[model samples]
Target chain A: MRLTRRDALAVLAGLGITGGALGLSTLDPTAADGDGSSGDRDPAETDLLATMTAAAEVVYPSQVTGVGEFVETYVTGRSRDASRQAAMETVVSELDEIARDWHGAPFADLAADDRDDLLRELGVADSEPVPEGNVSERVRFYVVNELLYAFYASPTGGRLVGIENPIGHAGGTDSYQRAAMDGGQSDVNAGENDG
Target chain B: MADERARAPVADADVCIVGAGPAGGIVAHRLAESGQNVVVLEAGPRFDGDRREQLEAHVRPGLDGPWEMGGPRDAFSSSGESFYPLNAARVKGVGGTTLHWQGMVMRLHERDFELDSRHGVGADWPLDYDDLKPYYAEAERELGVAGAMDNPYAPPRDDPFPMTAFPPSHSDSIFAEACERLGLDMHSVPSARNAEPYDGRSPCVGYGTCKPVCPSGAKYTAESHVEKAEAAGARVIDRARVRRLEHDESGERVVAAAYTTPDGETHRQAADQFVVACGGVETVRLLLLSESDRHPNGLANSSGVLGRYFMDHLFAGMGGRLDRPTRQNHVGFNTSECHQFYDDTEPVNGVKLEFLNYAGPSPVIDALHADTWGDELLEQLDESYGTHISMGALVEQLPRADNYVGLDRETTDDLGDPVPEVHWSIDDQTKTALSRANEVQASVLDELGVDVEWTVGPDNTGPAFHHMGTARMGDDPDSSVVDAECRTHDVRNLWIAGSSVFPTGGAMNPTLTIAALAVRLASSLRARLS
Candidate 1:
């Protein structure tokens, strides 16, 4: 199933969750369909996310599986103000246009290698200013990077990166390497001094 | 009647100390104990044990785990492109910034006192190491520091620490093993947090929020000294921000201090002698703000060097995944520390590195290391949690006249005063030292059998609230703001305390050194008053 950004927002709001970032619930165990699809979604959001996924995959291929979903989750979770919602919509539209212009075919239909080439070009092009009315290269780069960082750093993303969740306390450990060696030497010295 | 009603009468005292942090508090306590009428003026609100808990709750929302600021996050510097927020919790309470400090207390290395003599960089302190040794001992006793006095790199000491070092936690043990494998000496970290009760304060419960106010009185703060001073009949007025120094016609001595209460009511407090113990930034700010014809550049800035030579310890973190899961994941915090590389000198220069050990990756900061997506990332994170050892390096920054704090005309704080504009750029030599420290840290971690995952980029440099040397001390009044006694050269009765008087900040934390200096200043003030 597919979902539109608006539809996602409505669904999230109905569930009484509000924020600018996706939490654990969006990837709930029960919410997962047997086929690994976002079950029973409208066609519009799916098409939009598919395009975004294609563009993001080219930029960060390692994150294709979850990056698009996290971005959508973030956009939907943020304030329901028209300006913000419109900005998200514009981002989706620009991704679709960039994908189509880079490749002769629709983004979802492009091969992974082709997508990667286009993304590299976009990244390089993004280092400088683009023509007015076109999405600034830095903004595109930032959105892609932010999405990748936020997702990978998130709980689910951390699992993917192989970083464990909070395993212990912060700033509570003495873990200085010098202190440990000194401890051993001190013990030996204590024995020697005892004689 | 009209003139009398317009101005509040100045109340005289034996001594009036600005700020109530470590230095100010100690000075007040010592002076009051010496039967002097001491009045301490603190700009921050009064924070007792009960009020501390409330302050914690107010700040808890800001400490949303690691990688999050516990209060209103300040905007990133306009000059720097990095979005990573620089959050230094400045407590406007009686304890000052010590209220939210990690209670790591170590005296400045003996070599640190004579930087100019050794390295020919900054001016050597007028006083020598031996002169400050007794005061260092007194400060340690007052703070109830716990550690082994057997540090090879440490300077000569007359006595030992009050208590034994705190036991190493699980992570600390693993890190210690790694240090041992690398042929580096490690020991229990010396901390201001009580290992066992000494004074009236309780021992540290190992609560993770040491950067914030400690709810339990385990951590020593300036408020403790304030309490002692008050009990000895020293009045401490909170929320009183001193505006300027009111002087007589001679301009050689400070007659009184004009301060504004929280209600914006102005009053003048007269004293026989005045001491400016306000922290580095505020001390310089106040001096510069107190402009008069006698000293145009600022009080005690005759050499035209009042606000110069700012320094802060530069910190860098390097981490990698361990070969196997150790007991590091089992503990709340680490207790072991590494100081082998502290005085490690190259062919040309020496560099210092202090080990910063944590039990686990903070929830938010851990994300920086995670993969963009997938099950493999999760697996890696899980394995790394127990098997990872990260090393943070705190290197000494050379004092440069360029790095300074001044009032920003454009920016202002909530109080309508000009916000402090910090202009600090490290030199190539300091940058080289930082890089070398990273190299040593990585080598140490690798020797521990940890898989090299990633290191943070080089441009990620920020001060950790340990700002110092804005008002440095030197023999010459023209080159330095204060003299060896921390007294402003221009104003005979005016004195500056805390790290502001430091000519150079060593690699170690500055709290202990500040406390020692405060005690020394107290002695000087006591002799004068008596």
Candidate 2:
């Protein structure tokens, strides 16, 4: 599936990723694969996109749409970097091991509710998303945080939240002089207000 | 051993300027326009590639900075109380630092030239503000400055700016209201960026990445002048680093400049006159490396002050969050500034206040670090993203004998020559200035009912990288390297340009002053050559 910028935004809306992850600390770009090594399986052989898509369905808001094709494109692009692909592969394998131990199934094959429970049980939320830390922290950095960064950095995700254009995208002089159209009040807030 | 390498003849010219930055570009253009043979040697390659790609490099994470030129070749050592990140602040190319400079082009105040005579601190400039007034106007015209005439604290200018000033960013209006309450005036900052297209360049489209890259070509860089100089028949050779200046047997004049090419071959460019415009640090390094039997100290160092009195501007800042939306990050460059305390040089140094437009937390980064995920994450972003406001001040740093650019014998660059060692420290006077600036900033923020978040004073202050006063100009040869005319007193045919000749730097950006001096030096050379 061809993932246009629109598709990327759809994926991000579901992911609900945004800023403040990278600011925690600079992730070691060259972090080696974990010592467990996923039962000595090479990370290159792992199905990174499939595993991430299944995980996205669990973490994403129930209202979000268009998760599949965008995840495919994002994973494909991310896998081009040897280091990032290695980290993704290691974390995916570790995640699958946890799923098998807990539910007796692969992570992608588990039910959405079961997958969500496994993530919570692993204490991924409580730990800092360190690149070289334990399995849970690596999952937070590589999987959860990466998805959020890609979405908010996109034009659609930014516009959905009243940031018509993110940094680095040219918004022209008028954008600087004028106020943000929504005053940074996202559609999510509007929905809650209407309710 | 590197000197013994066979020297190839590069070019013969009436004048050879050993840098392609702002000063060198201006001098080369003015001289070449008069039909004189001119050559400019640059240490780095021209950034002639697609700028959009360069911008992408800057925005993308885990990549090197905007320029691909600053690598191992530009290494240096910092041995001061504060470790100076030398290479991060400067660029070496046809356009030089202006390629990445924020494009602020403020002029020195009248009192800046009389610091010693009036304030009894720092030596007075040999030439007053009036002497450089005409050249300042010419430089403003040449650079296509956009400014408002509302700056009451600035030195008087006879001519209007080429373009009208850009309107302040939306966030600046927020600070203006608070400043009004405190009885402080907010005026437009004079910038080299075009408000409307004047010199065949586009108006600022607000790419918001003006520091490292301006993909739209809105901000003015010296490459335009370098190109103009070339059109008028000046030869600019990029990727050629001048190793040393070779003087005559009498050591009274510079005879030739020996430089090394990328292929490690040494070449000599002979000229009737030489202008060393390679910035404050590199200029001193080149002069120190050119030591000989006759000039045991260094070339143009008869006064023993070539590398003395190094100076840079320090910053004081405060950041806070407001309840209302500030609409931050909408603009990249600042538009409003306060120069109210610029002339008050008693008890504390001068300070220039600024209201920053890019102060808030980046929405993407903020959301990513949210403790909550899903709906709660979205709520956190809505609550936190657009409410940040910040203010900053440029504090004047007085020159000290110990704060200097000396040669580091232990560290060397790609050329096997000793790198420039920056001996820098924040003095009591500078700390006092920072505290005063912070007090003023805090007052404005407090008036706006902002929740104070972080403050930057003497302990956290960093250099603005306005390198000045190393090769200070003065009337007395016993205390200075260059004379009032910017010609080296020890060497009649040698000249120095750029901020290296600034005797006392005011709390202002130094590019306009550097450009004015360059234009003046070119006029002086025209008379001598004729």
Candidate 3:
């Protein structure tokens, strides 16, 4: 049966889940299952993923989840990547300028596969002389990581990747109940009532 | 008039106190009540609840940013890059950092104080849980804690709490039930936030912004004690940054202290005795700055251990997805905790874990998480905002000499004072402890039938705002900065208060313990005066 947001939330609540996971389940995109991993993607998605993985491995060599698809998905959704749009635009502009210098064409006009290769080259070039007004490589890495980490580690990403959101059942007394039960006599509670 | 005149800057008082946070506030209140004329010198401005602009400046960027001591126009560049820790915005005001603290009060279990005796590592404090019990009780009464006293995990105390535990928010109830089902001992977290109309303060409105400053006065701050001290006739000076302590040629006694005011004028205030209640970092920095020919390595550097053994709690997140939705969109930020991992007698020497209750990431904070977003992401955010469970462990860090704080020669604040250069690192024991805690967290989530996601690692293990131990206390002057009474070994008249005196970084929050220690010191000073 089709589930509405409210209905899904109720089911989640009934099942004893709470917080961001419930919100995410309700907003689950119809195209999520298209790629069998909860979102729609072009058939060329595999190539993009491979490229992203290679770059992420170099950037966050110690990090285990170095997949490019995961990083792209995270940047597109959870991160404040859009807020860094101005910075992204500068990078894109520099890429276009580089393309014009090399092939006398705009970056967008290049074949999709070629575009990936060019982007990879830009990422790997340690000390390449790019246009003066372009974004720095450090800024690119910062933006990419910020987007990737937020999307992958957030409550939403936890749900998609089968990472359990611990808020629901990890053992503890709610502060109010502890306070109610203990009467707030804890050490920090000392000298609290002189007012 | 006679008392005021006699109390005014005598050659010396019995005890000179420093700082006015939990330790300083408590010490001052207890000593003043015992009839000691305690002089508290705070570098920050006096907190006026009406000062909206000053309060707002804390969150904004620049030198006078809310986290900064001077106003936004001041020069406060963050050294957060090399430190890998956010610069703590410490208030130089009367209340100290308590003015902008979330009052999650818990005790360092009996095992914590006896870490050396039990674990065969670290220096054991001269005093133990038993010695501090009465003081702890007195502090709780003064702080007006609202919690149950029957916690099995907590050490034994003499008296009960003033009031019953505050009611758990709707979200807390769900988390508590889940914990019990998993066989973990969950208890009410002791907070400085009010649960009832105690001592005239109102209950918390669940405003969520308890860090910068509690507008409602529901959270406990040293300002409340300052008011009490004022009512009892203790004089307080604000906007006065004590530059150094002046001594006579003999160098046997402290003559007076020199201070700088906000108006760029220098003034010398003569006092028979002095206390250093500035924070851990400042207290050490001040001593180092007060270098004299008689005592070269700063005020009390004879031992050469004035600023060593610094430590702070290392935090890690344990997150997972539950089978059902849990209430995440709740008002209260944290109301419950898992205290089962508190005691170290069970054989773990390095770290301990606690479960924090509450969910739903704020928009800005959500952006920090790279994994959870998009239409598919929104589905998870919505589903788990209230229903998800996230538990984190505030691990106990080992006392390493390398993790100490010193004055940074290159970076100076607006007043030309050197900013604190923190040198911090973790040892193998700490890493092992964190890994063990993470494993337990995973097991607990599995029991709840939720999908486990992120656990603590090198990238995720970051420093919390709760910084401590730059100036530690011990029985021997050769090994520590301060003594059991929070007095500096080098300067008899100089006392150090606040979490800086902590010999070992405990798993629980440090404010309550700091307050209790302060109160105990104040009482000691009063007795000596009498």
Candidate 4:
């Protein structure tokens, strides 16, 4: 989970994000997750981070590694907004209340399968993800959808779906100019050796 | 102390340029390079921070948004048939809106100069494209343009672009096939971005955030000229907003540029000659704000045409998902465009089609907004995100006196000056053009076998942020603010640059034309001084 600069570049290359890393380590902030620790963050913020990370495990693809550190970094960064902080807290508390009533545990403390079942039973996945709407909508909006967006938006998760260089990342000209091969699944080895 | 500061000249110069944008940057560099004492007053600050860090922050989700570009300092209102997002379209900083521009730079077609003479609709430019041809070449060199000479529909060029054209993106190749099928000539889009290492700046490393932010600084911003101007001995003052132009007793010449600093201290910049290059909206707003008894309408409004003839290119788009991967958001800027419909006469005046490199919702955004979650959401993104393809077109909007930028009586900015009230509307001609452009785009998309998802037609068209024709140039002083030389008809020493003086905005991007006119104006200013 803790990658050196060279290792991060190697990982980025392996992910098909960039070919022959031209100092594009900044492309994926999570790729440079040193120590993988939330150092000196506020206690309440840490709690929120934990809740979000727990939720991310259930929502994210099973293949996606480092869900904890990734969600922690993303959630901590987004918590700068007071309203977003409050919204996360509200949603987490609502989920925790449901967990306590049904499964006699906090949502973060519940098993991943049980948490997934609860989310499904609550219709959180089916509900419209309105930011200011009801509990299910808020859960869908702030937790499920937000975490999903963060994962795929990252170069690592984007590479899973043929997005070699997501939107804001600089993967160089050859990466974009090279046509996709074998349907839309991006030939990972096609232009890796080219300039 | 404030009164004392107000009376003292901030800087005395042979020439004073306001707005420090593409126009002012070019003029300042040219004049200062000629050994003239030039001073530029910019309303915005220089973004001297680490651009890579800034771009990283910008790309991050759940942040306030990209680039700390606009705020209360750039407040403006709009009221008409259609709403104009004025602040979103502009940046009031050192490079101006070019700092965040999409870097597409194309020369105006020869017929664009004779809109009235040829089409008998909009007013004709006093000077033709031939007049600007030399300056256009010079501007291309200065901005480090890259283009292919394959655009058969483009106006005749005496010289090739300064750099080689960038190869088409993977998506562009996909679109090109469809375009070829539809008999649309898709050629390389001329851009102000670097295709190779020409200037000191690096070639495009494809940071992909060309608009609002270019992390690698490959895309040309007027800040380059501003820096060159400074090195050539021009005094550049940032965060100094020019409130108004003050004329001498005769009112025939502008004597001083009265501006306020960020510290709320007012100072006057004395100059022998002045140039206002504050884009379109703010240019009119500044002139309107300087209303005096001698020229009660405004300093340059003796002809009563100062704030009239507002123009912006209306955009039409159609987007859909092809079964195969179109590879969306790969290059961030368009690499190919179609100018075949530019001179069309029937449904629209002019049109330029672009095959967008960054099409469809970003993977993150699509995942975030998808109704499904977990496995279903990932499946949806895999199917939808990369497969999305979109085509966009710029439709010509003829200048109308009623669509103008005037002083907003209600809203005031951080400087307490009345903000610009934009009265904008889409005319029937423009609406018809949008509809026609959409039809053409639909045919191409349909040819590609794309499942058409969304289409932006007349009802949902918006401006491409190419503000033009507020202070139109003409031969007659009776009907125009500036003459053929871009000098104010009323004030002999006052000059106007940028697209604001354009009589007709062709369906091309205006930055290249703006740079061309800036070069010409610099030559004119140098001649007057000599």
Candidate topping DockQ: 4
Poorly placed runs, candidate 2 (over 4 Å) = A1-150, A160-162, A182-195, B1-9, B365-380
A1-195, model 4: which lDDT tens digit per residue? Answer: 221233223223322334234333233334444322345445566668778888888787766677765666566445545787788888888888998999999888999999899998888867877677888988887888667655664556667778766654455677678776322333323223322
lDDT comparing candidate 2 with the true structure: 0.79
The digit string of per-residue lDDT tens for model 3 on B270-340 reads: 65556777776777778887879987887877777777887777776787666554544222346566666
Instruction: Supply the global lDDT for candidate 4.
Output: 0.80
Best by lDDT: 4
In the order shown, the candidates' DockQ scores are: 0.06, 0.19, 0.04, 0.32
User: Model 3: runs farther than 4 Å from truth?
Assistant: A1-195, B1-18, B50-86, B169-173, B176-178, B345-347, B350-352, B363-384
lDDT of candidate 3 over A104-161, digit per residue (tens)? 7665566644554555565522322222323434323333333333333233333333
TM-score of each candidate structure, all chains considered together: 0.68, 0.82, 0.67, 0.84
Chain A TM per candidate, in order of listing: 0.47, 0.66, 0.32, 0.70
Summarize candidate 2's per-residue lDDT along B304-375 as a digit string, tens digits: 988889999998999999987777775568889999999985544779999898887766656666665665
Q: State what share of the real interface contacts each candidate retains.
A: 0.12, 0.38, 0.04, 0.56
Better of 1 and 3 by lDDT: 1
Q: Where does model 4 exceed 4 Å of error? A: A1-56, A66-110, A113-150, A181-195, B1-9, B53-61, B68-70, B368-373
Candidates sorted by lDDT, best first: 4, 2, 1, 3
Q: Candidate 4's residue-wise lDDT over B1-530, tens digit each?
A: 66344334546589999988999999999999999999898888888855654554455433444546558888888989999998778887888888889888999998899988887899899998888899999999999999999999998899989999998888888887877777889899999998888678778866567877786778998989999999999988888889999998888988888888867788889999999998999899988998888889988898998889999999999988877777777667888899999988885478999999888777765665565666777777776677888999999999999999999878998878899999999999999999999999989988988988898889988999999999999989999999888999999999999999999898999999899989999999999999
Query: Least lDDT summed over 10 consecutive residues: which range in candidate 3 chain A?
Result: A184-193
Q: Which stretches of candidate 1 lie over 4 Å from their true place?
A: A1-195, B1-10, B49-89, B326-334, B344-350, B359-384, B414-416, B456-458
Could you tell which candidate, 1 or 2, scores higher by lDDT?
2
TM-score of chain B taken alone, candidate 2: 0.96
